[model samples]
Target: MTRRIVEILKKGQPEETITIQGWVRTKREQKGFAFIEVNDGSSMSGLQAILNADLPDYETILKNLNTGASVEVEGILAPSPGKGQRIELQASSVKVYGDADPNTYPLQKKRHSFEFLRTIAHLRSRTNTLGAVMRVRNACATAIHKFFQDKGFIWVHTPIITANDCEGAGELFTVTNLDLNNTPKKEDKSAIDFEQDFFGRRAYLTVSGQLQAEVMAMAFQNVYTFGPTFRAENSNTSRHLAEFWMVEPEMAFCDIVGDRDLAEEFLKYIFKYVLETCPEDMEFFNKRIDNSVLATADNIINNEFERISYTEAIDLLVKSNKKFEFPVEWGLDLQSEHERYLAEELFKKPVIVTDYPVGIKAFYMRLNDDNKTVAAMDVLAPKIGEIIGGSQREERLDVLETRMKDLDIPPEELWWYLDLRRYGTVPHAGFGLGFERVVQFMTGMANIRDVIPFPRAPLSAEF
Candidate 1:
């Protein structure tokens, strides 16, 4: 059986014969023997194989074992006299499945920029940085499932295509099957008739699964939705993406306080899990990518997050004596700079700000007794402004209806959602965490595009 490079590096002893199948990372021709580094994508480091000149077809195999070549080596393990790794492979036979021309391959020995690596997304995974990132990403995903499942939260799969714009931002990608060359129009011709489209009405790629997750939460009591979400926003910043993954957990009989507790615990759990599971990778990120990577993780795992009200947060910002680019006002939303200052400078840790103004929040947030603010909360980390946003849902039928009507959200379209309030409604709450954002935050990767494998952005969807 073929042994993974990670296993061999960790536990393989001398004189144990094994075969490793992977792409060659680098090759060095010595006086008597040639050394080639092999990686199978199982870990951050690769295994070094020593090929003697006396072996049959040694010259041909050495010639074929370029940096990007695919090969299988059956060798006996031996303790390396080298400085970095523990063991090295003494190969008896080397078979080259495919050869990569050294002149043509883009990934050479030297360091390449992340911007250039993104152009060749198909092959960038072989790099040390990208490889480490993917490993940490996988660890985070596993940790999420394990955390939720251990807490008895059901993993709910919500629909990808939905008619309701949950955010009410009007940024939605329409889904249709009608041909544009000859479209079906109404008698007035002001708009195309969506009645002839697929599903017999206008449809869109879902911007969020929160509403559907709420539906499932009503039945299951505690449910979480982890799936892809779409957005049609024309943003070209380091933060926005046309397609991304979201983790939303909804619970019945829960209020804003319960929601805040769960969000804090969830983040702490994920960070701790990643640190424990991928220590080497996490260390690499700390030493190489960003110096504060490990410190941030330690801050999250050790310290209790500071909690304050949104009104209080605004007041602190105003008295901070710092000149911010955006105005620090009561009604305006906090920008990234403001959030980073609050977490990085003021508290020096994570902060949970609650009770936001109702105008800035969604219509479903529970209205406070003051009628000017809602029972909403945002968990702001040191680097990232708002990591998680949630609110206690409006359970009162009369209040929800009035809020919907005030916002011009037609009541007929969400009749099913309204039905939940009409029958057996309880105070519920949930929050959404961007999967890529968490990975980027953990890995200290600057751009959000580097965390996701295939990033769909504005007019850029190449492999």
Candidate 2:
């Protein structure tokens, strides 16, 4: 028996016999006939099977056919007048693989909560909604790789476990040893020692691939890294996650403006790629997930992204009537509310907020001539506050050293980074895009948990 997709079978091919193996979605038995709905993980719509009482194992199949039962169904594909259905299968045989006790199978033929679905994550992928999401996610991931490869950018893999916090944010998951028995540096003064920590000398998960990407950029001129980054922040919001994937690209001989331009182009390319490649998925999301998805993609592709200074963004926010939880100010870091106000209300379009105050921005950001602000930019979308944050790194050795000193950063940890400037650094710039943030923006998903396969936030990492 040949396996066939229900969608393919529904193309009006006459008298076509096919084999479909899937979990039974629903089954209804009558005196003369039995109808069953089955999906083989190929499409949302499943092939309905019509079984007559005269078929072999008529009583046994009917007795076992129930929702959630896994079985191989062999039948002849035919047209159906079943209201919404376009196709059905006339079954001659049923092969049971897994029998589901109706009472034990938690999932049914109805919608379920994301939280509830998350609890049954092991089985959630079987659901139409989640299955579609996973498919879209896989496509997007592939698109990212293809997008970079086509553009002649080298893909670099930065280490996940690192000795330094790239962002200086102090958020890291410390990797440890399994054997608590044989610890290195068994004992130190006061009988307390940390030299035994897995990697030894306080190593932890990487916060960003930016710094390493910078190293690769210097060597290759243009390089990118797409990988997992860990943060230990405890905030519970729709956006924050403990472990998230980031797409970071560093370019040599590029300034802050170049960094901002790259961000805009990269995003536009992703939007175009996904929209063209994942039309069905996007259509489903536009209808079921967010009604504005198509429009959002249209707007992104059709319009030019606006650019403004951080100070200008603050000014716009201050004039607005939006009551922000965090007060808007020029010198302070823009909260998500402030960012949203700028992107959502002020600009009413995708915009780049740049030139943040040196004190508020990262230490590696290049200092402007004013000696007050850093040459940094954050691309903010209407719904998502800050989707991409990047900066033209301080390439001047003296200036970078002074900034590091101002931040009270340990000189030893960044010796190699500083060496880049000392040796041959030529005004490099780069940005980090939270991959999940992009998916959330694309799918209109509200929670970071739903976009990622196995979300490892502050507390949840069970699976």
Candidate 3:
């Protein structure tokens, strides 16, 4: 049986015969023997194997065992003389499955810029940085499931194709099956007739699954949707992605304060879980990627997130006398710069800003008694501004309908959603956490594109 490098590295005893399969990360040839480092994507550190001159097909195998080559080695584990690792493999037999031409391989034995690595997305995971990122990403995902499952939250799968624009942003990616070469037109011949489309009406890749999650939450009491969401906005920034994953958890009979508490606990749980599960990868990120990675994780895990109302945050920002690009006001939405100032500069920790102006927040958010603001909240992390956005949903049918009418959203289109309030509506709350943004925050990766495996952005969807 082939042993995973992680398991072997953690518990394998010396002088045990085993076989390992992985891609060669580095190779150093000598007159009597050769040394090769192999990684199987199981851990941050690869297994270092020493290939002797008397191994089968030694000369030819040595030539083929370049970086990026696939190989299987039968070896006996022993104490390493190297300083970095505790164990090494002494190979008795080696088989080279495939060879990577050093002349043409994009990933050499040196550092490459993130931009260049993105171009070779198919091969970039072999590099140390990307490899560590992928492992951490996996750990984060597993921790998400574990966190929710431990609390008896049902894992709900929401639809990818939705008819209503949940965010009301008008940045939806339309889903249709009409041939544009011979399209169906309206009577005026100006617009394509969506009546003849596949779904018999306009459909789109879901921007947010909170609505569907709300439906399930009403039924199950607690539920979450972790799935891909899309937006058609042409944002070419380090923080935006056309396609990404979201974690949204909805709870029935919960209020704004309960929602805020859940978000804080959820974030702390994720940070602690990832730190414990992927210490090596996290340490690599701290030393090489960003020096603040470890410290930030420690802060999140140990500290209680600071909380303030949106009005109070604005007051603080104003009192600090910091000149922001976008002016801070009561009715205006908070920009990234303002959020960073509140979380990173003023608070020096994660800040939960609540009770945003109703005019700026979603129509579904529960309106406060003040008649001007809604029970909406945003969890702003130190580096990644707004990490999670959530609100206590409006459960009163009359108020929800009025809010929808005020926002000019068609109430008839969301008949099923309205039905939930019409029948057995209970106060419910949830938040949407961007999966990539959390990974980027945890690893201190400079670019959001680097955190996701295949990033879809404006004019850039190569893989």
Candidate 4:
């Protein structure tokens, strides 16, 4: 049986026969023997295999064992005489499945820029940085499921295609089956007749799953949605993606206080879990990628996140005596720079800012007693600004109806949502977290595109 490199590295005894199937990362030929490093994508470090001249078909096998080639090697584990690695594989036999030409392969034995890696995303995962990123990303995802499941939170599968504009941002990607070349038009030939298209009405790729999560929470009491969300915004920044994954968890009979507690606990749990699960990868990131990687993780795991009201945050920003490109005011939304300053510079830890202005938040956020601000909260982290955004939902029927009307949102389109409050309303709250943003934070990667396997962004969807 073929053994994983990670398991062998951890528990394989010396002189034990083993078989490893993976792609060749590098090869160094000598007068009497050859050395090749093979990675199975199970860990950051690859297994170094030594092949002697007396091995069967040595020249033929050597010809095919270039970088990026796939092969299966039967070897005996032995203590390594070289530095860095603890053990090395003494190969008795080798079988090559495919050959990669060293001259044409995009990934050489040297460092490549993230921009060039983005272009070759198909093969970037084989590199050290991307591979480490992917490992950390997987650890994060597993931690998410484990954390939610441990608390009796049901994994709710929300729809990717939704009709309602959850954020009211108007950055939706319309989903229509109507022929663009010869679309069905209205009687006056003004707008495309969406009624004649699929779904019998206009629909869009969901920008968020918060509303749908609320519906499930009403039934399940506690539920979470982890799925893909899309936005048609033309943002070309490192922080924005046209298509990304979001984690939204809604809980019935919960208020803003409970929401804040859960968000803080959730973040701490994920950080601890990832560090425990992927120490080697985390160490690699700390030593090579960003020197502060381990320190940031330690800070999050050990410290208590600071909590402040949005009003107080605004006041602090105003009194800081620091110049900001965007003006800090009470009613205006906080910019990334402002968030970073509060979390990275001032607090030096994760900061939870709550009770945002109603005009700046979504219509579903519970209107505060003052009627000016909503019970919304944002969890801002160092380096990355807003990692999680959530709010206590408006459960009062009259208030929800009035807020929807004030925002000019069509009541008919969200009839089901209004029905939740009209029939059996309960105080509930939830938050939406960008999965990619969290991965980027954990790895200290400069670009959001580098964290995810295949990133979909403006004018770039090759893979």
Candidate 5:
């Protein structure tokens, strides 16, 4: 029989019979009846079922039922006058499919640690916290697609397996299907024996889809990629994940300023959208995670982000008198501490730090007129440091060639990338927004692992 949700049941629905399926959350005893709290997968809040003493299995169901049990109940809707809740179910029959033994079920009525939840990744989703996170994640993803589609942007799918490294960092998870016991020896440790490998060439999972999206943008003018990006960095921090979703938007004729503007607007749109669509879940997070959740949302809608050059950000960091683990320097990459200080202490909000030193940035950043800094911007949020990083790509063929050479990147690896400049190239720019990081910020979740459903990290793919 088809089951109905408790939330959908209205008061005074006179004697309508239906079936309900869910895990039993609570059970209460009464003189003539028992109220069984059952929650379907729809939500955490369960519905009350008043089982009459006349039913043959009422006593058995009540005695056998535990906090978490898979069951189906055939019942009729009735008006509930006991509390603020409007309706209750009057059960006629109960069938137990699975019983959650209290001795084994990790999740009891009380709260559990986020770190502890990671051990039981398979069952974590059923918990109230993870369920709320996944729901908001769904809403945020939908908002991203809607925001781009409404603005006439085409969705581009970039390859997951790539021939070259996108980040230029040697961190890559190599792919091979050859026999490990009899693997061929390579001078450089690359999987060069194409005869045995699956792809027939030195290929690995893509670290980012930026370069391929650039190809699409050259023709489509404006495009975005929403896909998985694998990074093989072994740093065991809460922020780093082996595989994560990256939202990258590339525009054919846009410059650094254009990229910054779009990045700000795009983030604001998602933040606003989630707040509007997932109010109940966000409310749950706000009460459980952070008390300023509602106020933060309201302020985000009304506030304009602050922008400053990377030089200015460093200067602010120096003046703050904060003892940083990594000392601030002119040419050094902005550490997380520096980013947090600029966003929290100096600007006291979301801050855009642009024009980083060319030597410290990636190879694709457009070299500025001064030749010392690159046309780039990083959107640093108050609590979470650098959430977004992007820049106007080097469009000038000669300058790009020089930068690539200086960075020790071979021109042949980026054949099609250079071909864009050789043929029909316009000023293009884009940025990568860490999808898990956004969820963490919005939900006030402490770790990146807690936000994503199945987090991929080094040597830990057990889910």
Candidate 6:
């Protein structure tokens, strides 16, 4: 049976015969023998196979085993005399499934800039940085499921096509089947007739699953949604992506305090799990990608996060000596720079800022007794600010209706959402963590685009 390279490297004993099928990373030829590294994407480090000149068709196989060539090798595991790995493979037979031409293969045995790699996303996964990122990403996904499942949270599947704008940002991508060249317009011809569309209404790709997750939480007590979300924003920055994954968890009877507690525990759980499961990959990220990667993981796992009110956070930012580009005010939302200062420089740990001003937060957030702020909180990490944003949902029907009116949101469109409150509303709470952001944070990847395998951004969806 063919064994995965990770399994062979970790558990295969010396003299044990095994077969591995993978793509070659590098080939070094010597007078008597040749060494080639093979990786199957199971781990960061590949298995080194020693090919002796006496082996049948050694010259042809060695020539075929250029970087990026796929091969199957049957070999006996031997103690590696060289440093780094515990064992190496001594091959008896080698079969090349495909050969990557050294002249045309984009990924040669040299350093390539991330910007250049973005152009060849299909092949970038074979690179060390991207491979380590993917391993860490997989570990994070497993950890998330394990954490929620252990806590008895039901995994909920929410709709991808939604009619209501949950965030009310008005940056929705309309889903229509109508021919744009000869579109059906209203009698006045002022606007396109969405009634002729597929849903008979203006539908859009969902920007979030938080609203649907809330509905599930009301029934299941605790539920979470992990799925892809789309945005139509035209941002071309490294931080923004047109398509990304989200992790949103809602609790039926939870308040802001409970919400804060759960977010902190959730982050620490994922960090700890990744460190234990992918230590080698994490170490590579620390050494090659970012030196503070391990230290960030340690800080998250060891220290207690600081919690403060939004008013206090603003006061601190205002009093600090550092100059900020954005204004430090009570009503305005906190920018990334402000968030980083609080978490990285001031606290040197994760900081949960709560009780945001009402105007800046979404209408669903519960209004504080003061009526000027909402029961919302954001968890900011050292390197990346505002990793998680959540709020205690406003359960009062009267308050919700009034807030909707104040924001000019029509009541009929969200009648189903309003029904949730009219029937049997509870003090529910939840938060959203950008899945890519968490992976980027864990791996110390510079760009959000680098962490995800195929990134979707403005005018950049070739992969």
Candidate 5 vs. truth: CA RMSD? 2.4
Give the per-residue lDDT digits (tens) of candidate 1, residues 332-442.
998999999999999999999999999998999999999989999999887766778888999999999999988998899999999999989999999889888899889
Show where candidate 1 strays beyond 4 Å: none
Model 5 spans with C-alpha error above 4 angstroms: 1-18, 186-195
Off by over 4 Å in 2: 1-12, 178-192
User: Candidate 2: deviation at residue 345, Å?
Assistant: 1.9
Better of 2 and 6 by lDDT: 6
Query: RMSD per prediction, one decimal?
Result: 1.1, 2.5, 1.1, 1.0, 2.4, 1.2
Off by more than 4 A, model 4: none
Candidate 5 residues 133-237, lDDT tens each?
998899889999999999999999999989896557448887778787878757677744655577767788898899999999999999999999888888688
Q: How many backbone clashes does candidate 6 have?
A: 0
Quote model 4's TM-score: 0.98
**Per-residue CA lDDT of candidate 6, range 259-318, in tens?**
999999999999999999999999998998899989989999999999999999999999
**What's model 6's overall lDDT?**
0.92
**TM-score (all chains, Cα) for each model:** 0.98, 0.92, 0.98, 0.98, 0.93, 0.98
lDDT of each: 0.91, 0.83, 0.92, 0.93, 0.85, 0.92
Q: After aligning candidate 5 to the native by TM-score, how far in Å is the CA of 53 from where it should be?
A: 2.5
Candidate 4 lDDT, tens digit per residue, 175-290?
Answer: 98888999999999999989998898888998888888999999999999999999899998888899999999999999999999999999999999999999999999898889
What lDDT does candidate 4 reach at residue 334? 94
Q: Candidate 3: count the clashes.
A: 0
What is candidate 3's lDDT per residue for 1-463, written digit by digit as tens? 5889999999988989999999999998888998999999999889999999998889999989999999999989999997888999999999889999988978899999999999999999999999999989998999899999999999999999988865674499999889979999999999999999999998999999999899999999999999999999999888889999999999999999999999999999989999998999999999999999999999998898999999998898889898899998888898999998888887788999999999998889998999999999999998888899999999999999999999888988888999999999899999999999999999999999999889999889888
- Candidate 2 per-residue lDDT over residues 336-365, each given as its tens digit: 778777777766789898898998878899
lDDT of 2: 0.83
How many steric clashes does model 4 contain?
Answer: 0
What is the C-alpha local distance difference test score of candidate 1? Answer: 0.91
